[model samples]
Target: SKFRQADFNLDPLWQIRFDRPLGYFAEILSTIGILGFLAYLILVLVALNKAMILKTEILIFPLLAMLIGQAYYYQNTTSSFIFWFWLAMIAGLCSKIKENKISFILNKETLRGRIMAFVGIIVISLISLFGIFFISRVCFADYFYKQSSKKSVGEEKIVLLKKAILINPYFSGYYITLSQAFLNNALSESQKPVKDNQKIFKLVVEATNSANKATQLSPNWVMTWQTLGMIYQEVLGLVVGVEDWGIKSFEKAIALEPTNPVFYSKLGKIYFAKHELDKAKEQFIKARALKPDFSELQFFMSLIKEEQGDIKGAIKSLERLQVFYPLDLDIIFQLGRLYFNQGETDKAIIQFQNVLEINPNHLDGLYSMALALEKKGDRAEALAYIKKALALSPENQILEKKFEDLKN
Candidate 1:
């Protein structure tokens, strides 16, 4: 009964024949278009029926094309399996078509006709072989490209991507992915001991070359420029003009996609690092206007407020953030510390207790709570809290000394 209903919509699943009026009309039009195409293909096959003895084999081409197109459009595993199964059927059908056609020509036609038919079969076979080879190469390249994403090791992913590039040299995405893998490897190598500066240099060079190749291949792609900019900014270190290159790249990305808050945020951070605080604040404000609820923007705003000697404004901003991310321990800890600095001991103690409730082993929370207790004239409770903190971090010389002093 459910299946029989007309407007029974199930999102991200099947849309059957009678789903909606528009869908019904769309299906009718598609069916008509397909049937018309098939009719035209049948007529073409019929015209070649005299020379081509295997009419069924000739007809199968359009059917296979239709099946493959449908499979690609639906993008489901079952449809893919059906497409492959039909592909297998085409192989057997091709052999049967060739054998039957040859036999028919030898039995019914003259020797000259038989010879011509054999020659035609050879030409067709060559074309079919070339088509199969090309399709197989493309399919294998796509498979390897997909595999590269699931791999964790950068070298292994690079190998897979290289294989894909060898098969599909024209695809810009393969080069881009390869570039990213090289950049990751370079960053990882940089963190290790400086025993091989040449090796790190080589990795960085490779990353730059691959990224340059990607940009050349797709000059208009915003993501390619963004990736190149990030590589220049982060991997190459902030050399004299490197930050300018990064800024220009982000500017290009923003020009192409003006409404994207992420691009604005990145540009703001670059300005922030350059200590151009006024320019940074303007970009940050624009980004905040685009994405009002962005937590990172709020955090950055609080930092800017603190930098400008507006401690109360900073505290108020963090308190507003607490309403959005109440359970975030980092925000709670920072808020508690801010309150403590402002001599709001009772509020600071409450926040410290909340932190300890969330994570009982938080050393900073315990130490701060002890200090708040001492300030409240509850020396016994202060000593108990300090003892707990000392037990947790027994190797801390400072905490051990504080514990001894409190015991006295």
Candidate 2:
């Protein structure tokens, strides 16, 4: 009775609020448990069958990557987490296979063993390759890959990958993979100012050549073009006077994959930087058409439109952006300004209110809200808001003038 009574002092609502985090944790643990069980069952079955049939089976690195990847994906589902998880799973599988584990499992000799063993191997290989493809896509999109510098570990990976490619160099992926390693190294080295540009430049050219080879090997591979384009763009940005070359590279990528929103969006940025508003808008609109849900593209379009003196068009684009990312502070602030520019005080006030609700300390929101109140003849409320704005931005002369005017 005493023990039970002692356990009853917790607040139920506090416990309920705590449950949400616990629930997420439990979900992650449950997923991991299920994957681990599956691995155990599969490995055990393969080992037992090998023992019985006097043969070993290959451990499917790809399948393991997939299983672990799916588990991790469901665990956090973020790109970075997924990247590291997939990376680890792939490297682990490759390491295991390099140690002859895959062959050990697949070499099993049994009437029933051969069928299921090959099936398992095929399934696993597919998942691993898929993981590699997924990782490659991310690398193309972000233009970076993170690899550890532990010589033994990373060398093992490189060696294992080389071995895999040797077994099948006809696959375009082998070239992509080799390119990724170089690209990753180039990226890491590029960040270190002390690192020699000549060395980095050599690596970049090699990476570009490899990526181009991959594209040549598989012309239909959309990812290859993208990667090659990114390499050109990033490396050229570092070495000045390569804008013409960079534009050509982007054009090649666009030609290869015209429908990719990211490709168009990136090209649009390049065009915008070149002061080619019409060309920039063309690419941005194409990107918007392809992926309407891409809020950032709309924002870019808005910026271009505003630069071109199309305030109404800019406002429309911002409105569209607000729908997808309502709490984006920049979007909210921009929408407010756009409305204010058009002399629509009521609409501007609503937009400012939204910003203040999301971020009470927002300087622009506070100042605008105060002005809107003053315009409506609510002197007392307006003055109070002005004081609040001034409190947030004591150095602002505009707020000081408004505050003094209100007092007068």
Candidate 3:
């Protein structure tokens, strides 16, 4: 992480989780610690030794070669499956090779040994039964969790999720989902014609509690903090101290994932909402450094420039972005509006035309095109463009007044 470059921490996900690492050895060292790695090596060595005892040692080279191939690049998924399958096959072959050497003769001399074997078998059987019971509980919890996902009705979904939590309360994912569910319910309750403040408060509280529980259960998991951050952010003004809570949540997420640009960007948004422009700009600058090429970051930077009354700076930032994302409708539209603001009507018309060329049916583009054309004294063309916009959005009061004004 110390030596991680521009997208340093993200490299692990792309290098290993999303793709393969330098080799299976590197992967093993990263995923499994030294103990598990040593166990894997021991298994291979014992298997190689058994192959020698069975006089089938020649087959070991191909198996080693297959593993070595994966060291650099995967041969295929089948080759990986074959590697483990071959290990099992070799172990079975060795077992059959030694089958006739030992006999279970229970005579007076071996009675004590046989009884000890029987006791060991009972212990193994009990362990297997316990494992089955544990697995069955997990299966039931997962089944309920999956059912909850397919449900559209909020109450049904909540019931299924609660049932899943009942079965496996330790799973952080269940609490995360429950937290989100409660948040969604709260939003829905607020939007109703007759809002129930008490119900909304209860839902919001439940959402926070569930999110907190998730963080407690899997304190190290980045998603838990992120989810908690979102839950707190949503109820910022509706509930007291949630602005501070949201800030704290995003701060925790940043501490855990310092290189991730998204947390910085979102934290900046919260600051922007609070009108702390300098704080917002600082966060955006950090995010831009981490991920300079992302269009969203550029948009944020341009927005900050606009908010700070550096209209020319905003336009300059957007012009550079235009070179990269020529088809981004919003960026193009914004550039045209900025040019129009500076009384560069001709440049604005060119951008509006570009927008219309890309999306002929765009209402905003059509309306903006009419205004730009009207500014240039092209009355007939402007009228025609406004008509097109009006036809698209007949219910818009602004369009109606503009059309009536043009007619007069």
Q: Compare the candidates by TM-score and give the number of the best one.
A: 3
In model 1, where do residues sit more than 4 Å from their true spots? 1-137, 186-205, 230-241, 327-408
State how far residue 1 of model 2 sits from its true place (Å): 69
lDDT: worst 10-residue window of model 3? 10-19
lDDT of 3: 0.82
TM-score of each: 0.53, 0.39, 0.62
Model 3 C-alpha lDDT per residue in residues 242-356, reported as the tens digit of each score: 7667778888888876777777888887787677889988998898788765577787779789988999999999999999999999899999999998999999999999999
Estimate, for each residue in 8-72, the C-alpha lDDT of model 1 and write its tens digit: 22322222323232332244345578777666456434434432455565446655565446533
Clashing pairs in model 1? Answer: none
Q: What are the RMSD figures for all models against the true structure?
A: 10.5, 18.2, 7.5
**RMSD, candidate 1, Å:** 10.5
User: Which parts of model 2 have CA positions greater than 4 angstroms off?
Assistant: 1-169, 193-196, 241-258, 306-323, 326-408
lDDT of each: 0.73, 0.67, 0.82
Best by lDDT: 3
